[model samples]
Target chain A: SQCPQKWKRIFCTRCNSKRHSRDRCPSVWRVYLLKDDRPKKRKKLILPMHSIYCYNCGLKGHFGDDCDLRRSSRVPNEDGSAFSGDNLTNSLKKEYFQ
Target chain B: SKDEDANILNMDFPWTINRDHSKQKEIADWLTLEIRDFVSYISPNRKEIELRNQTIGKLRDAVQHHWPDANLHVFGSYATDLYLPGSDIDCVVNSKAGDKQSRNCLYSLASHLKKEGLAEDIEIIAKARVPIIKFVEPLSKIHVDVSFERTNGLEAAKLIRGWLDSTNGLRELVLIVKQFLQARRLNKVHTGGLGGFSIICLVYSFLHLHPRILANEINPIENLGVLLIDFFELYGKNFGYDHVALSVMNGKATYLPKSNWKELHPIKSTFQLAIQDPGDATNNISRGSFNIRDIKKAFAGAFDLLTNRCFELHRAKLKDRQGCSILGNVIKYRGKARDFRDE
Candidate 1:
C-alpha cells in the first residue's frame, strides 16, 4: 500500500509567487518602532526582493493607504484590469476583491 | 562623548521608504529585533524559573503525600514557555481513582494543601466542566490551577513544545500576540476571548502559509515585522470568516471552507471562527472563543495603527522620530521586568 500525495496549489499575485497567495506576500509594506535602548552599532540585514509600487500615487516607498498624494487614475477600474497592487492593506484591498 | 554621540545617532530614524530602497526589509529587521527584545524582556528569568520549579516540586510532594496514587504535572503556557509575567501555572493530576473530579476529592486536596501550609487563597471549583482547585503559593506568590485527570492540557503542552522546536519565530510571535491580547483583555476563553491554544494555532498557520516562508525566500528572523503585519491583515480584513475555517493539522496550514469541514457540522453559527483541533480531528479548538468580531476588529485596528505609525514616522523629521515606539501602541507591559534568560 502506498500513501497518496496531495499537491497544494498556491499563487500570490502580489509578488507573483507560485508558493503562496496574495495575503502572505512580502511585497506588502510594514513599518515598526525603534527601541530607545543602547546598541551603538547595528548590523546590516538581508532584504527580500520587493518591487511593488503604490497603486494610487505610483510611488515605491509606500502603499495606497499611506499614499498622501491625491488618488490618481492608476486605480483599478470596475473591470479589475488596470494596475492591481494586490498587496494593499486589507481595509483598502477587500473592496477591490469584491 | 561616545555615549552622547550614540544617543544622538539613535534619535535619528535611519530608514525611510523614500530614502531606503529596501525599506520593507529594514522595517522587518527593526521589527524582528524589537520582537526579540520584547520576548527577552517578558520571559521568566533564572530566579523566576527556579521559584516555579520549587513551587511545582512542593505541590507534587504535597499531592503525593496525601494521595499516594496521584501524580501532578505542569501544563499550559507555563509548560509551553509562552507564559508572560504573573501568568498562572496550569497543572493536572493523574490518579487511579475514577472520581478525582468529585467534590469530595476536591475538598480533600484543598484541605491537604491548607494543612501543609503550601497553599493560600485556595478555591475548589467542583461544579465547573472540569473540576479543579485554584490557589496562590504562599511563598512564591505564583498562582496555580490544578485539574484532576485532565491530560489534554499536558498533551497540548507537548505539542506546543514540538512547535517551538520546529517553528523559527513561534515563541516570539506567540508572546507578542499573547501580550497584545492580554493588554486588550481578549486572551481569556471564559470571557469569549481567544485562548492560548487557538492563538498558537493562528500564528502557526500564518507562519507556515506565508508566501516568502513557503518559498524559502525570507528568513523569519529578518522579516518578522512584515510577517506580523501580514498576520493581522490576513485575519483582520482578508480572511473569509463567514465561509472559511482554519486548520493546522499535520504541519500543513490551510483554510478550509465551512462546508468542507465535516467535524464542524454540529456547530450552529456559520459566522463563527473555526479552528480544527490537531489533537482530535472531530473537534473545533476555537469553539469557546465567541468574540471573533471583537478579536477581528482589534487585529484590524492594530494593522491600521502599525501602518499609520510607520507612515507618520517615516515622514517625520529624523529629530522627531526620537523616543518613539512602534510596538508600544499594541503591547504595553509596565509590570516588573525580568532578567534575560541565558540561552
Candidate 2:
C-alpha cells in the first residue's frame, strides 16, 4: 500500500472540538444522552438558593407566607373563583386533598 | 490682748448671758437674736426654717470644740420627704475615734448645751433608739435623733437613699394601680372576697409589666429607685403607717384595704365572690403597706415571670393551718396545665 502523508484529527462528539482526544478532554464536555446514563463526575457545587418556612401554612421547606399554595387553597371562593367554604368544610377538603 | 479681744468679740453676748426663769420674753428675745446671729454665716437659700437646724448647728459647734474631727450627716424622712409636721429630726455624728470616744464626745456636747441653758427642758435620751439618740428639745418640742457611728460606714445611709430613689417608679405605678383598682372596685378582695392576696396579685402583675415597659425605654437604676419609693408611698397611704411599722417591728404579714386590692381577673371573680362585706367592716391596715416578705415575694414573682422562670413559693401561717403558699395553688395549677398542653 502507498504511504499516507497526513492523518486527520479526531473531533470530540461531546464538545464538538478538535483540541484533544476523547480521553484527555475536560469532564465538562461530557454529556449524557439519556437520564439513565451516569452523570459526569466534577467538582462539588454550592448553590446560592436556600429554603424557608411558610408561616401561613405552618409548614417547612418554603419561602414567604403569602406564596404558600396551601394558604391559597384555604381562601374562600364562593363565586367559584378557585376554592371556597366554611372553616370546617375547608378543613375537611384539605384533609381529603392532602 | 488683741487675740483675747478677738475671742471676746467672737463670743456672742446673747448666747452667753443667761435669762431668769421668770423672764420669758427676755429669754425668747435672746434666743431669737442668737439664732439670727448664727444663721448670718449661712446663705439665705441654704437657711432652713427649722429650729432643729439651729439646735444642730449649736450642737455641731460644741462637738467641734471637743472632737474637732467629728463629721455630721443628716438622714431619715427629713433627708427625703416622708416627713409629716411632727417627723423627728435625724442626724449622725461620726468621729475618727472609736465608739467610746464618740459617746464621750456626744456626752460632752450634751453637757455644754446644758451649761448654756439650752438643755434645761430638753430631754437627752442617751439610750433611746439604736443607731440614733432621741433628744427632745424643750425650745421647739422637736425630737432630734443623733447617732455616733464611723463616717466610713455610710453604706446603710447610701442604701437608704438609693432605695428611696429607686422607689419613685414603684410609687407612680402604685398610685396609678391603686386608682385603677379602686375605680373599678377590684380591691374588694379582702373581707369576703379575694382578701389581701388580690393586692399581692395586682402588685405582682404591675411589677411583671414594669421591666417590660422599662427595658430600653427607661433608665433601669433611676427608674427602679423611683418605682420603689412610689410603691412604698402608696403602700403607706393606703395601709396605715402603723401597720407598716408593726409589720417591720413584729415581722408579720400586713393587710391592705379591700378598695385598694386588685383581683387578677375582675370579671371572673365578680360573680363567684362578694365585692364588699355587708357589715361595712374595714381592714385594720391598708392595702399599700408591705413587709419585707411581701416585697421579696413581689420581686421574685415579677422577676420569675419576666425571665420565664418558675416562681418559688414561701409559705406562712394563715388562720391556724399554714395558708396556701404564696405561689398560689391556682397559679401553679394553671402553669402546669399550660406546660402539659405545650408538651
Candidate 3:
C-alpha cells in the first residue's frame, strides 16, 4: 500500500491563504521586500513578467543576473531597442518596491 | 552485477557537461537533468540505506539492554535523509531519568559497546558540552555519534523534514551544496565550517526569496542549473554578510537584514553568518560556523568556475565538448558513475 501523504496545516501569511503556502502563493512576488505578514498591495496591477526577454540567453522569462545562460556575442536587434538594462531595472524596481 | 560493473567502468571515462544549446532554457534543461543524475549517482543506494538502518537497530538494542527505559533515537542528516556517503549517524538516548549525561553513564555505555563487539574504536567524550559516545560499527564500518538526553537534534530533524516535504527542489539543491562543501573540507562544524543545518538555511532562504521563484515565473526543477549559479553568485559575491541574516521561522523563509535581527538579538555578532534558530529566535543556528570568509570565497570561486565552464562549453566545438562536466568543476562525485540520460 502507498504511504499516506503527510498532512501539514500551513497558513500563507503573504496572501492569507490556507490552500497554499507562502512560497507557492500567487500573491507573493518579490518576498525580499515584505516587511510584515500583511504584504503591501501593489499600486499598479502587476502582470506576469514571464514575457520579459533576456538578451544573454534569448529567453523571455528573465534577464540580467537572473539569466545564467552564456552571454551572447551580439544582441538580436542592433538598431531597434528590444529592451534596455536601465528600462528593465527601472520597471522591476517600480513593480517590486511597493 | 553486470550493470554495476559497467557503471564502475563508466566512472573511468568522465561525463559530458553540455551539448549545443542556443537558448538559456535549453542549457537550464540540460543542467536540471545533470543535477538529477548527479544526485542519484552520489546518493546512498538501497543496500547502503539498509545497512544504516541495521546499524541503528543494533545500537538501539544495546542501549535498551543497559537501561530498559532508555531508547536511542536517530537524528541529524541520517534521520532527515540528507546525508552524504561516509557521514556519521547522529543519535540521542532519550530517557525519563536525567542522569544519562553523567560521566559514569558515558563510560558504562562505551564499555558495553566494546564488549558486545557491535562497535569498535569507541571514544567516550564526557567533558563535551553534551556528553557523547563515538564509535564505528564493526560490520558496516559506519561511524556513529550517540549523545545523552537531547531532543533539540530531533526537533531540528523534524523541521528539516517539513521543509524537504514542502519545498520543491530543496533536496536536490541541498545535496549539491553539501557535496560541494564536503569536497573542500568546509563542512565540519568544529573547525568553523558550514555545517549541514547552516547550508540548508542558506539554500532554503535563497529559494524562497528568489525574485523569479517568488513571482512564480520559473519552475525550480526546470532551472536547477541557473539557480545553482545564482545561488553561488548571491551568497558569494552579492549577499551582504554583515547586514543580512537568514531565517526560516513560522514556515516562512526569507533574508532579514542584520539591523532587524539586531532588534531581536542585540548582543549577537553583527558581521557573522547568522541564521536564527527556527526553534528559538533569540539563538543563532549558524553561530558556531565562524569561517565565513573561507566559505564566501569558496562559493565565489565555484560561481566563477561554473560560469567560466558554461561560457567555454557554449563556445566549444561539438568534438571538444566530449567528457567535459560543468558540475564536475565544482563537485566531484567519488562514486561509481553512470550516465542516466543515455539510459
Q: Which candidate is the best by DockQ?
A: 1
What ranges in model 1 sit over 4 Å off?
A: A1-98, B1-25, B266-269
At residue B191, give the lDDT of candidate 1: 93
CAPRI grade of model 2: incorrect
DockQ for all models: 0.05, 0.01, 0.03
TM-score of each prediction: 0.74, 0.31, 0.75
iRMS, candidate 2, in Å: value is: 33.8
Residue B89: error of model 3 in Å? Answer: 0.5
**Per-residue lDDT of candidate 2, residues B246-334 (tens digit):** 11111111222222333322222111211221112222222333232343233333322311211111111223222212112112111
How do the residues B221-295 of candidate 1 rate in per-residue lDDT, one tens digit apiece?
Answer: 666776777677666655556655677677666666566678767545355788888889789889899898899
Q: How would you encode candidate 3's per-residue C-alpha lDDT over A1-98 as one tens digit per residue?
A: 46443366767776575766555442221112121224364332343454343323333454334445433222122211212222223445566334
Better of 2 and 3 by DockQ: 3
- What lDDT tens digits, residue by residue, belong to model 3 across residues B287-326? 8888988898898899768766765666566677655566
Interface RMSD (one decimal) of model 1: 12.2
After superposition, the stretches of candidate 3 with alpha carbons farther than 4 Å from their true spots are A1-94, B1-25, B262-264, B267-270, B335-343
Q: How are the candidates ranked when ordered by TM-score, highest leading? A: 3, 1, 2
Instruction: Give me the TM-scores of chain B across the candidates.
Output: 0.90, 0.36, 0.91
lDDT of 3: 0.69
Which residue pairs does candidate 3 place in steric collision?
B17-B324
| Candidate 2 Cα outliers beyond 4 Å, as residue runs | A1-98, B1-53, B99-106, B117-132, B138-140, B151-153, B160-343
- The alpha-carbon deviation from the true structure for residue B33 of candidate 2, after best TM-score superposition, in angstroms, is 42
